[model samples]
Target chain A: MTRIACRQLAPRIGDLPFNRELSAAAIRDAAGADVIVLPELVTSGYMFASPAEAAAVAVRPDHPLFAEWAAAAGDAVVIGGFCERGDDGLLYNSAAVVDRGGVRAVYRKTHLWDAEKSVFTPGDRPPPVVRTSAGPIGVLICYDLEFPEMTRLLALGGAHLIAAPVNWPLVERPPGERPPETVIAMAAARVNRTFIACCDRAGTERGQEWTLGTAIISPDGQVLAEAGEGAQATADVDLLLARSKALNSRNDVLADRRPDLYSPLLHRRAPS
Target chain B: MTRIACRQLAPRIGDLPFNRELSAAAIRDAAGADVIVLPELVTSGYMFASPAEAAAVAVRPDHPLFAEWAAAAGDAVVIGGFCERGDDGLLYNSAAVVDRGGVRAVYRKTHLWDAEKSVFTPGDRPPPVVRTSAGPIGVLICYDLEFPEMTRLLALGGAHLIAAPVNWPLVERPPGERPPETVIAMAAARVNRTFIACCDRAGTERGQEWTLGTAIISPDGQVLAEAGEGAQATADVDLLLARSKALNSRNDVLADRRPDLYSPLLHRRAPS
Candidate 1:
């Protein structure tokens, strides 16, 4: 694979036409890539201006807006976040892993963070590691990356690449350093020894400022290609190489796990 | 108080005399600051270069080095890692929180990483959060910072500052980013919302590459002051401010943990 584009899509909040148009343009530019990743809730910037608006903009998996970029997604795995309405009418933060073959697998946000728990329900089941045309891919929504065990679960189950879409807030600190969110992603990459295509949203939305630490990190947690403070960045990864590294096992953390000690906490039973 | 001197000491792999000299020199430079911290393994690098060399370096609580430093330690509270031979002859990776008053508490690292298990035993009990003139302090060794729950335990127990002494190796990835050891330390600062001062060793001894990412991290996880890629560095902390941030709970991660949902995992039976 030659390139993957991490689109730091910062569409205007609540502006459907503008967001659709802007996302289309980004898709055109990323057409040259093997994979293109976008930030969480990029289809709708952070989802809602208010609870009332959330219900209005929420769409199901078959939303017409996604149809616009389907053709451009040919030969590429285009991954992005959106608000999906479940059969029960509850809204879920979900990622669509689509190829020209159509939407591949949908991963709902598992382990919601902070204010999200108030709005979105926790996912009932774990995401399956789907075999895509490119490789066996795993997708995680923003907060899903925080739990070490979650990523470990995906990796041990045979996931080679983890695609993440996030909306990081503006934190005034180091220029290139990401607010804890990016660090967690990098940690996941190293521990799993898998490629992480993490795209973060950029620009200020009305009043709330968002930080974009769009980057493609290597299996060793190296940020190979990083977007600027707020820019769309692109990268390329070799899946075969990553698999070889994992199989051969060099100085890899995932290879050296003391599973006997970890099994207790991982398999621990909750009190009744 | 200003001008805290953080000593990034690489104690003798298994030599006690060499370890004492390194600690004594760093103590001499501990001038105006109200606190001082040194890297773990100040008395003897817990990892044995050879199993045969282990017994020769491990010290006891009554060792003269402890008394000498206790009596002469500057007006500041000085803390660093050492090796203590328990009655069972098992070596413990211990840190002494020493002040001019006396040796306050000796913390044995409760969590050990990787190869550490073969050389040293885990602490028998939990680390104590001791009250000091500078602030409420807690001590942890190199690998202890990796466990988020352990650090949270320290914070919940009313620790305002965590002093960790580490020996981290330089890594090739993340480009200019600090080694993974510092990343974990910084994450501890962010998650716990406390000031974390990490003293790490410097220099490439023989062929081994030691990464020096010594620094003071603020409650918000910002590096207040950092020692470039070498031995020693120092940073003055506004202890009261860090304590207030942690106490009042400015960052919501610490404040709003969904212990109810997570509590299940607490009582969960260990993995088989």
Candidate 2:
């Protein structure tokens, strides 16, 4: 079993020092968790006005802020998004996987959402499935969860648990229902038979409203724990519960895939 | 706008003539729909005890039963599943796209569900994108809907509406909530920006319970129409609602895909 904690904090844009302090406090408070996930761009915030504005707040993996995060992580693994300043001096919307030892892996956001394309370069490489004391954890940032291919690839790569750091903008929906992002996440967990921890930023950023809080879904698409708007959420889950992808004795979800029929999905040109 | 109807009827196993009559009557009741979808294996029913028993109930495309279905279709296009006796003389759990003119296209079930592999031959080719007066309709049967690749392929192949014929057995879930199948369909529709019409069967067949209803989901993931257990469902939807896959000004869902990084998904080797 793995104890997962989520810090759904609202960060002010360009307020690096304040955001770092907030993150450190949250990590320290979430003690005894095997893994703690924080929202996307928690350090720099979302809704960057311009490329220069975004680049201004970006930091390298070796930044002093990560040391605090690592120390706060204690014996746990922490996965959270940040504004990354790459070696090539380019800006990226990235997530760092940090443990007691140090930062283990970094994943740049692959499928940039609206307006993000103008500022950040899309990550060319697939996100890594980092092996941890708890289990294998795969990371995805915000809109990357909308693409099934992203989760599918991670599951194929042996990810038992997917950690998502999202800055979810609230879309219009009828009263008393989950957001589309939550719905999509639930479906992803069910289809892949993998546990998913989605940490979303709360409160409005600039004028855009965020779908605040977090959703921890089990392999069977059950909501283990979910926080309401502007609330923190956490869940203790059995990681080995997702080891079996079988829906029934005769039907194994992953083994039933017909790769031959899925060839059209790989082609650059759309199938006619 | 296109008016769509679904006939959620329960067919007794191996009862070909009675099933054909029931389908025709329902099509007549639907009256003025642009398209009507029916449940999987509507003719032969699901849960076959043996191959010979299933083959006994299967019919060829040119069989007289299709003539009645085509006539009952009126001016509307009908998408319904049947036990198909293929040209190779093998039985296939198949769906036929029929209209007033005749049968337009036939799609064999690609991913066989539990126990089905023993009786039916899986289809080799991808499901067709048949052009209709309302829009292009892509076909998938039952378990195929569980695979995100199937829906993504149809969307990439230029389908605006996906017609699903399903024989959904009720899975374990909390009482008084939507089934996981419905959740997956809603997510598929939203991610693909494609309207989905799922026609599911009702009642029990050989002690196995059925989901027994229908769900009509809009491109935005809203349930335009839904039916309770054993009830008929219908909705009038604008086909052009799916013309734009763009969620916002800058992000077109299909175009936003990074195909370059998805190559690992095409490999036949299951990653450890």
Candidate 3:
């Protein structure tokens, strides 16, 4: 069994020093877990007024904070989001996959959310599936989870588990229903037959409340653990179970795909 | 506003004459609805013992049954499934879109489910989005909804509503939870910002039970109506609402797709 833990922390806006310690502490607390996840923009809180404000807290991948997180993680793999300062001097909404050694992979957020278009540049490359001590872990940022193609690609790339760091802004939903983003994640997990851990941030930032819908979904699309008015959600699951996409004797989800008929999805324009 | 109705009628296995009257009666009962949906293989029930058993009731597009359905439909559009006899003498699991004007389009199930592979030929063509009096309606059959690419492609093809004919086999799920298939449909609707009406069959055939999870979902991914121990589920919705994929000022669901980075999904082989 692989233990997965998600920390739903509240980051102070533009306060990198405070968040750095908070994230490291969370990682240390869940050090025994095989995988630990933190919310998107946990290092620099979301709801920035301008690009300059976001850039103020942005850090490069080599920043010492990752090393701290690595040290705290021990044998576990940690996936958490940050405001990134790219080599090209542009800002990006990025997530880093770190183990005891160091930063293993960095994936920039491809599909930016509502106000993020003005604050960060969208990523050009696809998210990575890093081979970790726990298993193969795929990484995706907040809004990227909404795109089915993104999850499909990661699953096809042989990811046993997908760690998503999302800051889902509060939206109106019917009473007793889960957040829409969580529903999307559940569907993605079931269709791909892959485990998914979505870490959502807590607390309101600049009058914007969050859904706070952190969840750890099993391969069968069941919510094994959910952070309900809590700072953490954890679950112990057989991650290897996700490696088999078969639903029954004859039906394997990944093997059943008809890619040749999917070329229409490659077109950029919406039908008129 | 479009009045969408789904009739969850149970078909007798290998009894086409009985099912033909059953479906036509249901369509006539909901003739006032703008769109009416029926379960997959409603004409020839699921659980065929052999390919010959399925082919015994397979139909062509020009079958008189469709004309009967058109007559019963009045001004409404009807979308339902059947075992199809192709020109090449192969059998397919297919759905037909019909109206007072007769058959608008026929879409064969591209993704066949368990046991279906042994009885039907997989479709080479993509599902079609047909322009109807109600709105632009896309078609999918049974297991096809599980494939995110199928839904994504249909939504991208300017479908305001996806009319699906599904025969969901009963599967194990946690108590008090909706069927997994319904969950998948909800997620697909939300991500694509398109309304979906899934018509599921009822009753047991050959000792095989059904999920009976027929649901009509809004663009926001909320269930507008569900068939609960009943033969019908109906909802009044503005189909045009799905045309705008905008969630907020800067985020439009369809416009946010990064197709350039999705080439990996076109590959058929699983990663080793």
Candidate 4:
């Protein structure tokens, strides 16, 4: 069993010190969790005014603030998104996986969302799967999860659990309903037969309202646990269940793919 | 405004003549509809005992039955799945789009399900967008809908509405809830911002139970119309709504795709 905790936080733009303290506090509260996930841009917040501003707020994995959070996490694994300063000196929307030892993996956001295209450079590579106490956990940032290709690749790479850190802006939907972001996560989890943990930020930023919650979905596509709007969510799940990608006695989702016919999917040209 | 009708049928194996009559009657019933969709393998029931059994039930596009159905269809466009005997002498699980002008498009099943892999030849090409009076209609069959690549391609090809003819086998899910198939359809529709009409067949065939119903989802991922278990469902919706893929002032789903990072999707190797 993997005890997972999701922190839905509302970080202020450019408030690095305050966001770091908030994340550290969340980690301290989740003392017994095997893994704790925080939302995208949780360290500096989204909606940057300029590329230079975004770059200015980006941090290195070895930054002292990350070390403080890692210490607070103790033995538990922590996954959270931050503005990143890559070795190439470009700013990236990246998520890092941390443990008591140090930073284990850092994944740059491959699919940038609206306005982010102008602010941060899109990561060229897909996120890497890191071995964990429960199983291999794949990390992805906001908007990256919208592309099925991203999650499918992680699942194909043998990820037992996908940890998504999101700052989801509310889209128009029927009144009294879960946001489309949550619905998309549920579908992706079912199709890939992989356990998914989504941590979305709460509160509005620059007139953009967020979903303000966390949703943990099982391989069967059912919500195992969810936070009522603006609440922190936690759940313990058997990660072993996700290792089996079989839908029935004879059908396995990943094995059933027809790669030969999927060539167009890879070489997709921008919508004409 | 486009009037869409979905025929939820229970076809018998090898009963081509009877199935033809049933389909024609449904077309007659949907006379006022702009487009009507039928279930996968509607002409010949699914669950073939052998390749020979499937081949025996397969028909050609120029088959007399199709012509009669087209004539009965009159002015309205019809889309339905059928077993096909390709020119290469291979059997395929295919869907034909027929109108007053005759057969407009034929799409063979690209992603064959369970026993279908052994009996049917997978389609070589992707589904096409056939221009219609209502809008561009994209057709995909059964298992093909499970792959996001298939739907994304059609959406990129400028399809306003995706007509999916499915024969959905009931899968385990939370009780008294919409099946994962419906959820996936809704998610796909929302993500692509495309209107989707899924017509599913009812009843058991050779001991295989099915989710008997039909669901039409709008671009916002809300159900426009749905039939109760084992009923023919119909609804009229504005296909023009799907033409606007923009979620807000700044975001458009199709235009936001990061084609550069999706290369891994194209060079997929079958899962080990």
TM-score (all chains, Cα) for each model: 0.80, 0.97, 0.98, 0.93
What is candidate 1's CA lDDT for residue A176?
63
lDDT score at residue A232, model 1, on the 0-100 scale: 71
Per-residue lDDT, model 3, residue A45, is: 95
Query: Which lDDT tens digits does candidate 2 get at residues A97-214?
Result: 9988789999999999989989999998898899998899999998999988888888888888999999988788867657888889988999899999999998777899877648
- DockQ for each numbered candidate: 0.13, 0.64, 0.73, 0.50
Model 4, A30-77: lDDT tens digits are 889989998898899898888988887899999988898789987889
* Tens digit of per-residue lDDT, candidate 1, span A168-221: 766677776666767767766765577888898887776777766787887777
The numbered model that scores best in DockQ is 3
With candidate 3 superimposed using the best TM-score fit, by how many Å does residue A68's alpha carbon deviate from the native?
0.7
Error of 2 at A89 (Å): 1.4
- Stretches of candidate 3 off by over 4 Å are none
Deviation of model 4 at B39, angstroms:
0.6
Evaluated with lDDT, which candidate comes out highest? Answer: 3
Residue-wise C-alpha lDDT for candidate 4, range B51-147, written one tens digit per residue = 9998888899999878877888877889999999998999999999998888999999887787787899889888888997777999988777777
What tens digits encode model 3's per-residue C-alpha lDDT throughout A24-131? 999999967999999999999998989999999999999999999999999999999999999999999999999988999999999999889998999999999999
Ranking by lDDT: 3, 2, 4, 1
Q: Residue pairs in steric clash, candidate 4?
A: A266-B266
